[model samples]
Target: MAPSRAYVPSILLLRSLLRPLPRQCSLSHRLPSAPSRPKSKTAKSRIRKPDPQPVDFIQRGISDKPGDDVLNESGVSAVEWWEEDASGNERFVSAITNRDELRKHEEQHKRLEAWSRGEEDPNEPEFRNMVIDELKKNPSFSDMQDALEAMKKPLIERIQEGEEVDKEIEAEDEMSKEEGIREAQEFLQNLLEEPSLEHRRDQILEIQAKLTEWNSVDHPEFLEAMARLNEATGGESVEEFQNRLNPYLDIEHTALGSEEEISPQDKAEMEKLAKGIADIHDLLKEGGMDPELEAEFAEMRREIGTDDWATDVFAEDGEIDLDKLERAIAKFDQAELAEAKQEAKDEDDEEDLSPEERANPELKAKIDRIMEDPRLMERLAVIKQILTGTKAFVSNVKSAPDPTTLPLAHMTTLEDQLKIAENDPEHLIALRRLRVNLLPPYNDHPFLRPFNEALRFAYVGANDDVRRVLWRSYLKAKTIPGLIENIPDDAWDILWYSQAVDWASNQNRFNHLKILQKDLASIGRDGPPTQSVGGVDVNEA
Candidate 1:
């Protein structure tokens, strides 16, 4: 029935809350409003109508619009320009047709501006962070990284193993070299113990045969042994043996072997010149003149007699008898020519003589008596065989491969041989020849394992007497041709230190530690110090 007025108002408010809201039209679908005309003082102001545009209507039954189904099926409500959604959010309308494209362009422009300012782009992927994130999420990527680490670990181990193997090989090589040296020494000692020269020669031949079998015919020790055998068998001194082998030993002579030989006439002229110079020196010394002036006067005397000759030439102080001096020189020349001719004749006669005829008559008769005895004849035949064998041994050595072209193993063997023969003066020529040949090439050879091996053989392997000789030779050489000038600083340091240690160990006077300290201090003060040790510059030595 008729309730209170407050109850009626409450009922009406409830009814209003239950009523449905009207559907809103999208801004795109709504008709545009006409623009208002401006007011004029005259009442004749008229509004102009806008031109008509084409209209597109929606088809209901089967829609042809590409995105119509997606929007409808997804239950997306149309948002009007001024209307709010159920969530009470206001809708926005932009003038830009492609707002997303415009936003992308703006972002790109911002990136460009940031780049121009040398600032990192905000959108740029952080590679380290991305890698870390990938490692976290992607098990396969982590596995791949672990695999790479595992591979690297094995590679490092292999390199270390290879280095160890190289060290082992070097040690083995050193051991083998020492063994070979010992064997060679034993062979030499055995040969020395043989009482007879014939037996010694036979032992040397056997050694040579063994060396040939081992492909070490070019071994330095064998060459040296052959040299000694030649000297002994040929009844010659070391100098004579060296002189005979000069054609082979001399680098220049060997290099020039293929060239035209020097004419006998040229040799004779050279001899004459040399003899004349020597005679002039002798004459100067006898006359109490300065020996230093000898060379100057020798040249002058050969061209136009010296002032000393002027004294002998002049009869009066100013008036010189040049014709008489010329006659005397002519006579001297004739005498020299006659003497040379006589010598040549004598040599020819000597060459034509039989061995028995050439010998002293008494010696020849004794030899004949000895020949009658079978025992003596047998001994002579044995001696002849020894001489032949020794000559053959020398020939083999001469014909062997060039030491410079030898393999590292062979070169090492030769070095060992040189060490073995270092104490023997008889092998000096062989040592020098090998040293000269080997030094230049080995000094800078790429394949040389121990770079200073050749230098050690030359300087350290030698005895004290030989070392002194070598130092003297180095000093007197002024320059050794073909020596590598651009030797590494480290190489020089190693060589110098090794030599210093060797010297200190040998000589009781020096304290090696102090010497080393002094050198190190000098090096620190002035880079690569050029201090001298035992009268030799560190670098030069």
Candidate 2:
């Protein structure tokens, strides 16, 4: 029993091998062998001689012979000339050499076919050994054979089905919960469009009861619909109803400790809602709905539902909606507007009186109040200063020339004309600041400063008729009107005057400027004041 020892090379042996590498052979140097053989069986494939060329390329000095010109003008030597051209000949010779392997494969195929058809004994030892060897070479064939046996059962019969489809249906049921919630919300939204609040409330209650059966109380939209339903119940806040429903709403709280008891405020709010709901039912039974009040209430509810009620309150359409306007007005102290109305009403009720009879202590008090207004006085002072200063500046200063006709130096000097403007920094800043609100065609020219200031004063006094002295002073001045008419159309200083007139007209300043008011009446603007500013043609004014 000779024990075979696989030994590693010793350092001396390795060294000897390394030394021999230069002399040759470490472990049989990379072995490559060349074969010389006889091809006598392929005599037809012998190299053929080329036909003689019409012109002797070699004699033409294109040959590689000594003294032959490599730079032949014909360029024939550029090609690889040789004694024999054997390109592509080897491919044919190779095909011919492979015939025996092709014959062996064909014979093997025929033998395999004969065995499969039982023409020969497939059970013979040689054939059995071959089949077994092939199976062993490809183990996947065995797996395929097993699969074929299994496929004997039809696919339809092989499929086992039961719990899988049921589980899928259950998953769909879970996924359809959102769809159900959406349907419920849509139903409630339809109820909101109902004309009768009581009917809407009844439908909402029914829908709410059905929704609870679906156990959709946990959804946000469901909670929101519930709040709306409580509102539709009429006369009740949702909080009040929720307080009454606290025992049920806080049922989840029962699971918590006593520390999580519902707050008293919540209970109070719920109580209020419950009482409101009952009151609404009784009121609906009474059947005398005030259209205006109900409309206003509905509008308030809509506003409360909006995301930006503050901005909506000031919106144009919102301001015009009677319901929203009434509700908004109801929220504020309307004493001022009421006082104005009462005064107007009282004046109308009074018997026709002379101008002396129209005068009273109250009239004097109004004048005193206007005079006492520090804001009014301050505005007047500002207007006076603006007028005086603007007059002085426009009179003394010269206008810039047409820069287009001037050279670069002259244009630069024209720009330097700012020295005159720069001397009045305060005026420039003030005028520029006021320019933002200047009427059209009236830019921030120094000449327009007086008019702008006067208009600003007039606007401030528009709400207080007694404080309109400054407005009248500017409007009634011959110099101002003359300046306005003679001004260029491009200058538009008249726009400010027109604006002041418009402000006065808007404020119904007839009591102060009876002449302008009469003019307005002639023009069909004698009715109550409107929010819109009537267009006043400056030329006509």
Candidate 3:
């Protein structure tokens, strides 16, 4: 329905030919008049542009506006235009009407051109000046500048100062080591010369202080002095010195391990002592059992008639049947009364014997033989000392200010006695008695508290066998609810030191120690549900 493009040129040519030529005769008449006279003086000519017309209304759907259709189709409101000035030179009119927008565009264009030329933009100077002005308005700007200036120092000078500081530290460390060695030597000399208990105690305290300051127990000079001191003190044969030196010594070697080869005479004496120790063990075991008490208990059981008496005594609602319990208690009282009467009768029979009859020849001969054997006599002396020490310990524990109170000095004395007892078979029995009597009711006492002073003392003063017992006790103590939370840092340090000693002595597996060390390192990092001290979890312990 539209005309073909090929006919458009011919149609335009026909229209141009149909147009009439304008009045050629009138042009010839006007041209003759204009050429008749030329101006006497030349004049400059000026061209003036007409004023722009103002429109009252704009049509929305007009198609005659140039580029309007294209702008509507592309969704653009306005575009840049070109306009002729009065001098007939073309000038560009930007679509943006805002002066600030026009200035920003001009700056962006300059920045792009500068970047292409690998040069800094001209606008950056003005921007940097503006930023500096803003920073100057801050209250602390001058103070910050001063601080930065003060912080500036030459690298060489700082390195030199650091080196000097390191030298001073090295000098101090050397002086400390020398002082510790000298003090330790003096202590050892005084202990060797005097060998008195009071002198030894004071010197030992000094040595301990020095060791603590040095932060190492494995110093060569200290170890040598300690060895000499131990020899002079009779190598754990003297209980006081053993207790004082135990925290610094290898417990396995000094307290528990076998001695080196001895002379035949000394060996004979040792074997005799060994026999005596075995006898003591047998005696203690026999003394622990009471046939009368056992027989009474058996009779009581018979009287109670083994028919789930507990159920009969306690009703379904957990109330005790008073009649049945009273009958059972009456039977127990009768058994105890009979036992008491029999004991009194035996005492009277003993009193009826004459003095000479009481001292039988067989018993006298046995006693005389024991007195003649020096080894047995010496063993008996040690046992007497152990008994005396145990009695003193019990007295001290009972005389404390309160059930939960134990003075440190008294605890030290008790620990010394325990160490002495631990070295002999008879002494171990006494230690067990102390544990049974004191540990249960007075557990809050510092010396008897679990994983505290008690465990530390046991580790230091007792042998491997006793340590195993204490460790088992410690593990058991952890099983009690709320007990783990009460464990202190010192307890974990002691345990870690014990494990370290065990590992060093090749008594513990390396993998076990490794796992323990890892767990200790992870304590505060990945904390477990249970409380931990020194990185060891109570549950794991």
Candidate 4:
């Protein structure tokens, strides 16, 4: 304020020229400063400028981290990337502008790659390339069960449906139709056909193998196939069929998938009577017709000594006088009848009671009750006659080590002989001894009939556990002859002891007859009868 400043216009202009250029222009050392506007006479004021920010300078086509939003002052954001797909297609992705959307898109792409490589995570929802609606429309698609029915069909049939084959057959010429059908049939047969006897012997075995191989044994189609195979290999008789299917396929002897009307035991009993009559007829044929013999034979055969013989002998008017026939035979051959009676006595005398069983109070009571019943006594006497008289008949029976070795006509005779002589003291002494070993053992007990029926049923029924138990019991008896020796005559004792033994020692040669000989001794000294044999339990008649 003291001295007035000198105004040097040229010096002021030089100071202005020396000022640095603006940032927007080139920053070279030789560059001239930009021209500035002259100062106005307005009041001087300071303009606020923002502080400079630090910048990260990244090189293109080099190491660049993701998640970085590089934006200019104009609100623009972008990043460059490279990618290669599964098909080996390489591409340079354009600079993406959005950070959130790009991150999402990248994650999805990675998941897709993992899925295509079969690296699916269990926690995620199941994913298929095709939709479910599309899968159902395809007939070829099936689960584990559908595959089972397919297994039973022949190879060609499986490859093409039956309708398709029919169509193909229809398309063929008439001359070639037979050839086509034959080829198809042969093809079907070959699916399960076995050339080896070892394999073909058992149809059940073949079916079992197929079922196991295909894991479809329980399926209905597989069952049907099994039945067809069984029918193809089925035997003519129950014995033949049973022999063919020994320790497998527990099929019962049946007619049309039902129980036999007559029990095997009853049929066996009836056959014996028929055989006896046949023997008598043959003997009469050999003896020639002496008028006295002929007249007596006619009377015996007619059950009449006179015109009113039916009323006099049967009273109930039945055919064939069994008693008169016996008398007629006795008159013809007194020595033969005597020998037969003696033999019957011998067979009935074979069984004797153990001292312990004879001493049992309950058994003694049962014995007393049985002795008191006239029906039981009469039954016992008849059995004794049959057992004692069968020796001559047995001697006449043709025999072989293997019954099949006999002629077909003789096979029936062989089976009859085996059944009749099973307890006849030759084929099976152990079982015979078991039956007759009682103090007064009958040739057969009535309970034995039902007991055997039960065993046979159990063998083929669904009671596997019981069947195994009975099998083990039978094995024990069949292998050990000593077990059958000295068993009690009472049925209850036999039934009890048989089951309690670790190994069954009964041959089951006589089925219930062997068991009935012991009477319930298995139930301890005081327990009641077990009531059930195999699956058959005895019911009072």
Candidate 5:
């Protein structure tokens, strides 16, 4: 066995030695209530389990260490230690005997010292330092989560029983807790009060030679590396990047208390940097957790008007092949392509001699005669009916209608305008000739009202005309009393109507809008409410 560092002076016991030496002590010193506690014989047998490593700590003025044997025959485990400095002063590596009590006393001392120095407020976010770190960091996250979860059951039990406790004692506990939290907060405030390089922007631009003495790198290289990885991933494929960086994530926190690897001063800095790096990696992973939704390209094509020139652009993936596009647009806009395709399909249907085919080339002759008519409206009506219902023009329901039939009515208004442009060649020439930019393309499709509205809103940002339009829509919608209740409550906050109302009110702009004005009648009925807007707080509400 290794020698005990101090020998305890043969007559001294740890608990007893804590008192002043008798006779050499001052007259004012009184005997503490020791309660005649016996040396617990079975206390040695109350051994739990051994740590993978031994306990290690520093105390006020103790340097107790033992060799690898780890413990005495007694239950109290031996401590290990290291020398403090060049002065040959030694420090305790562990305190296993009075572990919990000693640690709590130490924490209390530190807190008292901090309070004496006015370093923190009495009430801040802090818990009992039961084991140095029973509280620290956001407990809602990371490995501490399971432990916090376990505490929920006990806390609920306490809360349930607390209902029966004397109110005064409960209030005292609350007061103590509040004081502790305030102290912690004030301590943080004090630490951050000294402005740094980033805090003093102007001073940072004017660097001084003396400032190098105080230069600090808040983030370590690991944090820098994680940040670089995050940036390189384009903030999209972050999960893959985080998976790649996960190996380095918990390095600094190898063990719950291994943060002591560095000196106290550097320990704080080290853990801060490591935590920041790990947190950033977590955030990167979170940002990309939502999988990409594949675009419904087939549905997109279906939405485009088949006979509209502007729509066929949907079939192409990239920049329009201008010459090819113009040709296709001309055919589509004039319904020529649709008509030719229909004719080809009709001829093919005659192979089996279906009922539609039995009508034969005689209908073809009639179709040609009808197409030659000078009245465009009458010809359009015939084409529309033939496409919508081949049965209407054909006498038999048994007929397999020609799939090649043109759908002139299904064509867009823009297609008709293009045809008119093709005839006149000069009217609205500016609109006809204007090209799409591809990026944020202008909505020029005459029949696509919603798309036009979206483009108009995007281009104009927020305007009074849009507000008025939205207000009228809201009025119409709310006029049906049940309609408002039908809308999901979740949508109420972000609803466009709410935004438009806010914009119209300009709640923060003109004082007259939010405050009372002298010109009540002249302000007009639509100005604002005579009192606060709808009796709401008008600021917070």
Candidate 6:
């Protein structure tokens, strides 16, 4: 598709915002330092009455871009035809006074409090003189203590009122703040809704950080207003709120990591991983499995969702649960027999109906509605978007999100990887610094940018909550064979990894990774050039 007209604008805005950001995540990043903004010529041009034109350049920047205009950080003459309203000066003066009036009240009040407490610094003659001069004009404002105490009543009343109807008062102020946020968000939305711009993605991350702060305080209310605004405009940037607000709500996230972010113990854990991979390779080559089992098992790693069935066999003590499987097989066999019997008894005319016909799409739809009677459509729409393709910022690592969501299998794999790495403490150190983690081997790594893109694509159709491995598990189930003899009881992780990779490489219609990741995917399937991951025998089956 030739890019939409709005696409470029949104991309520009996103690019501005995304400056200096790094990928995947960290508690710290290459942040934009406070730019030594040139001395605003207008700063000294004190608003003789909010000059309609840029009395100074700073004012020029503000007035030049109507709060709604999508202007760059450069001097504001982005469009030649833009004009100012006739009442701009009057309104500017009024707004300025309104702000100053409140500031004056607050300053006077604070000064009185400090003087009454006798805590005013002796060296600060300017403040002392100002207080004396103000008292001379209003002699009744004598004895600083009395004035301070007099102001206290109203201050306390105001505070109580603010506290009592805080949400209501906040609701009003938030409207104005949201207006500002919306303008900014609109600009940012335009910037990001573009063709893939990896570098710009980083900049958007920072802009998102700023938005995150705003969303944290007035989340419910702000989101509602934002929703309405978005509805009217069909803005694409609304998607970013999830990224912004989600992080703010999660206290552990900071922009990225600082020098002191990781602990020694975490470093130690990472060291074991390198060695772990090698060990698994060795074990797989020498396990007690029959050749038939080994070959069938290696080839049978179906993609995505099938691992759940695999995990059911592999229990936590790290052994297969054959009895459980035996029961499942019996129950399934019985159900199959009953289904077959019912089908045989069906009217002759309907005996050949396919599964889709049997579902009776219309009836199924009606039942689905009656059963939930909720926003099933909305949820499904979101689910479809996520499953079909990642909306933003997912990586192209080996594994993908599975729907079954049992973490035991995934966790066990990571634990095993870490265990193997135990031999090399420094590598463990680097791995430990990776705090907000996912299953290793297939994980989001900044250095591995290609993987990140693939991961994002995988995330498109998955939920951030309830474990994001849906597609991996969902699709894998489709490939299960007539006989469940290929998957071993103890090799659940292997099954998961193998299946996830194959699905991504073979079945996924759209490979989101660029040249490198697509190549990585190919190389990965072949297994990383026979390099050893510190041989610690990860093979359980």
Q: Which sections of candidate 3 miss by over 4 Å?
A: 1-274, 280-371, 398-470, 473-541
Looking at model 4, report the run of 10 residues with the lowest lDDT sum. 252-261
Q: How would you encode candidate 6's per-residue C-alpha lDDT over 127-216 as one tens digit per residue? A: 544554455444244447565555444434443443544464345445644654565576656656755544465565555566757554
Model 5 C-alpha RMSD to native: 34.8
Clashes of each: 0, 7, 0, 25, 16, 68
Q: List TM-score per model, in order.
A: 0.16, 0.14, 0.17, 0.16, 0.14, 0.18
What RMSD does each model have against the real structure?
A: 34.9, 40.3, 32.3, 32.4, 34.8, 34.3
Most lDDT-accurate candidate: 3
| Candidate 5 structure quality by residue, lDDT tens digits, 104-148 | 657767886887798843432132222224332333244675676
Error of 2 at 422 (Å): 99
Best of the candidates, TM-score: 6
Count steric clashes of candidate 1.
0
Clashing pairs in 3: none
Worst 10 residues of 1 by lDDT: 251-260
> In candidate 2, which residue ranges exceed 4 Å CA deviation?
1-144, 147-186, 193-218, 221-541
- Which ranges in model 6 have alpha carbons more than 4 Å from their true place? 1-218, 231-237, 240-417, 420-424, 433-541
Better lDDT candidate (3, 5): 3
TM-score: model 6 vs. ground truth:
0.18
Q: Could you give candidate 3's per-residue lDDT for residues 67-93 as a string of tens digits?
A: 533433434544565667668887764
Query: Tens digit of lDDT per residue, candidate 4, span 1-541?
Result: 6999997679879999999977762322333276444375342233223333312222432345443464434445766665675577866644567767567557656766887787854122122211222233333333543453343233333223434544643444232334423432343355445564345546545554564454422244544664565566552333333323211122323212111123477556545544444444444444343467556555554643344322332312122344554554454365346545765775655467455533346533543554465554444345447544554555766755686676765545433444444423232332222331211122133433334433433322323344434434443332221122223233233444443333322212233432332222321332433444553332310
Backbone clash total for model 5 is 16
Tell me how far the alpha carbon of residue 15 in candidate 5 is from the true structure, in angstroms, after superposition. 44
